[model samples]
Target: MSKIIDLIKAKEEGSKPFISIEFFPPRTADGVKNLYARMDRMKESINPLFSDVTWGAGGSTAELTLDIAEQLSTTGHVANMHMTCTNLEKGGDPKAAVRGALETAKKNGINNIVALRGDPAAGQEEWKAADGGFTCALDLVEYMTENFGSEFGISVAGYPEGHPNAISEVEDPSSMSEAEKARSSMEGGKVYTCRDADYKKEMDYLKKKIDAGADFIITQMFFDTKVFGTFVKDCKTWGINCPVVPGLMCINAYAGFVKMTGFCKTRVPAELRAKMDSIKDDPDAVKAFGIEFGIQMCQDLTEIGVEVLHFYTLNLEKTTYGILKGLGYEVKGSAWARVGDQVKTANGVGVVKSIESDGSASIEFEGETPTATFKKEEYSKVF
Candidate 1:
């Protein structure tokens, strides 16, 4: 099977835009079954350039993640497995399980991985480093490159606004209770944010990962296009050049949105937050707004020169389909399980801008400055 880096590179040959979707390993057998069916249907309909399966914190869902990844490969979908720096130690060797997982993926014909430092597992407030194991995603990237050479295509996570943990402390001199003042003086009540120095560290560390052989970056989700635009510019200023794919978090429910945004320390635009808060009580209304808002955000990203849009599908399809349909993509094919939509195109390849009533689509080619017309029969939708 082809690696994700190779596919991403393939997307540049013309003007076609691409998209990749991510799914987390489900906890139940039935959930897994449903996800497989959903993924199959999505592959046929949306034709995602590639799809990924997430590893649970501390490798809680390791075996199942591997199984699903293998299944994807067998079914001819290029699977990118997520591997975290947790639960990878045995007899004092930190790389035992990490190496095992990578080797297993290779044996299963999976050459793509998203190296992550992972969040804390269930009931844990902070991520604890495993003794003798890797400390962060940076270490994992370096280790993979050192051990595996060019055998695997690696992509690392980038926090466009800086990581949640990499924050600065602020001092407040406001009126406070005695205990509150004491706490403030100590490990205090000051809120953390990505300030100048912290953001510099984030940039520096990201460069290190790229230098360590990360082929591309997939950013943590952000609502503001300006933030993503600034990040792309700064990556150039920092001399870390590579394809930076935007991660889109599908707005599924009100409560889940609040919880995820709060946990990630993601900055929500005031208007968007208010929009969600207004419809917090009605599930259907909230979902409708999600699809509407998602359509707008995606259009903005595409206009801003974003190529491969990565959707955090959350293993659901309605919102994703709504957003794509709203963006003028002809959502087709069955809702039931099937496979075989793995055509990979190069970057900078012109995407079909318009589909005529008679089936001709406008596509930009290598020499064309303006998009030219092509028959729908002549060109394929690779995204």
Candidate 2:
């Protein structure tokens, strides 16, 4: 498998923009079938160098993530499975959960990982480290490095607009009388107030992870491209020269966009929000606006010379295809096409085809029935 770190370094050394796509673990048999179908349709337009499959909250989707990663590897594209320390123990103990995930990835030849401290489970009290589990993402990276050595290329998360948990504190206490001060002094006069930690804390944590063997960085999605630009500049100031790829999400539906942002704690710029609100009730208009907005944002970022753009695909191929086509991409047919039936296109092409249960397709091309199996990398070359 091609190491993600090597790929990022290659991009830094004059390679064209490296593009990738991300997907969440499928929840059911039908979901998995649907995802494979979409991957087939998108194999052409988004020839992702590597794809990432997220580990569900509370370690629910760990197995599914590995399964999907294995499938992607079979397609000859690297797959990165996300590993988190959200429920891991605080002290230095081998987290069975993480260990099992790493073992699965190794067995499946899925050598890429994105280490993180995943969000708490729905309605959970707070983020509590599991007994005998690691406490943070850095600890997970350290463990992976020590266990896997150079076998795995690791990626970590970066937040551009700042993490939601981050907050600034102000100290403003009125003067107290001598008697009251004397009493307070007896009870430990130091006042502790909650305040926002400096941005440097997050950066320092990221750097520590890198020092511990993180290969690349994928940032949280942001609507404002300027926020991403400033984030890149700050990374330079902090001496983090590793590839810091920006994550993009195309919000085609108003409700879906709102739900995703709410869950991710990401902001939608006021102007973009206004634009969506203007056509909130009109599905067609909202989709058109979303595609146009995403295309323009991508064009702007491309002009500025970003090393890579990663899309968070929520398993909706039509919308993803529309956004990519808007940004000038050529998509291949679904996973149904046979090997010999694959065709190349110069400009943007989007195809939606049917797939049978046996993972094969028979179609009439110029009065001949040709069969083809789905291949994902063929689409990347056209792009």
Candidate 3:
């Protein structure tokens, strides 16, 4: 088993944040091929220490998720397999599905797992425990820890703003007064409904998960660094000491921004929303703004002692690379140029290399050279 805990601890001790990237299952063969090709391009620039592969709805892409995890593991990066209780059997029923998934991941050499209580399926009003499946994320974590031993580094989700399912109380009296009048002049009482998680409650939950054997906590994506800072403070105050890596998604297009925030229930700052809204009709301008905003956000986060910046690379290169460049980071091997080989440019010169169908590339630059092989898919941001 890989020493994910040690690596995390080392990062904590050194005061340097580690970086991880995430990718979802591809819907088509072409998409898969393109993602692999892009991964090759990004490898050198992003230099991610780990990568996460997400399971699809209802665990539809379980097998594919394992395959991708295994492939990423081969690149010398830790691959975290995502597992959800949405499809697992619970309540003393046969643990066939969960067992099989874990065994498959083990067979493929994936030692880390991120367990989630995934969103309900389409057309479903609410998520119900699967017949014989575990009831919640904590149950899944307990199972993995017991079954996989100490080799598995388990991760759970944290919501800085609060979980959408959590509820808060507010005063309303129009209907209350009539009900009170009929009930012998009873006093009014507030009702609780499903709402976002309260900040303090969220901190308590994180502490519980840590005590339950979660090695790390990866947060739902957010736009504001202040929110993350507050979350860190609350974690300390609540005595939850596990590593919390902030999730970041580089918004490259207005449509993508809308879709992602909607899916994650993340707040998009009004200033950013306005900027995106203004360029909704212009794809080029939107792309430029996305890169700039993402770069600035990254720089600010790093400056404020964020230990790691986890990027959701929706399998695109141009925007990701543009953000890296804007942040003054260069692609790994672009410094040395070779004779007769020229780097191409959409806006500026890039040490050029041809990408393959499988999404791998060997980049060779002109002039003086360094001893490194550049791949396109490895970078979240490349200069």
Give the number of the best model, judged by lDDT. Answer: 1
Q: Is candidate 1 or candidate 3 better by lDDT?
A: 1
Better of 1 and 3 by TM-score: 1
lDDT value for candidate 3?
A: 0.67
Q: Which one wins by lDDT: 2 or 3?
A: 2
- lDDT digits (tens) for residues 1-383 of candidate 2: 78887876676544456778888877789999878766645554467877888888876676677788888888766787888885433244447657866887898898889998887765785776777777889999999999879888999999875654552222433454322221111112232221224456877888898889998789988787776777788788888888888888877789998777655556566677678778999997887777787777787777667878788877665556666667666554444343343333222232324435644433223323332333443322111
Candidates 1 and 2 compared by TM-score, better number: 1
Q: Write the per-residue lDDT of candidate 3 for residues 248-339, one digit (tens) a residue.
A: 88787787888876655565556876788898999879878878888888877777676667787776666666666676655463322232
List runs of model 2 lying over 4 Å from the truth.
Answer: 12-16, 86-94, 167-196, 334-383
lDDT of 1 at 128: 84
TM-scores for every predicted model: 0.81, 0.78, 0.78
Which residue segments of model 1 deviate by more than 4 Å? 12-16, 89-92, 168-192, 336-383
Weakest 10 consecutive residues, lDDT, candidate 2?
179-188
Rank order by lDDT, top first? 1, 2, 3
Ranking by TM-score: 1, 3, 2
In terms of TM-score, which candidate is strongest? 1
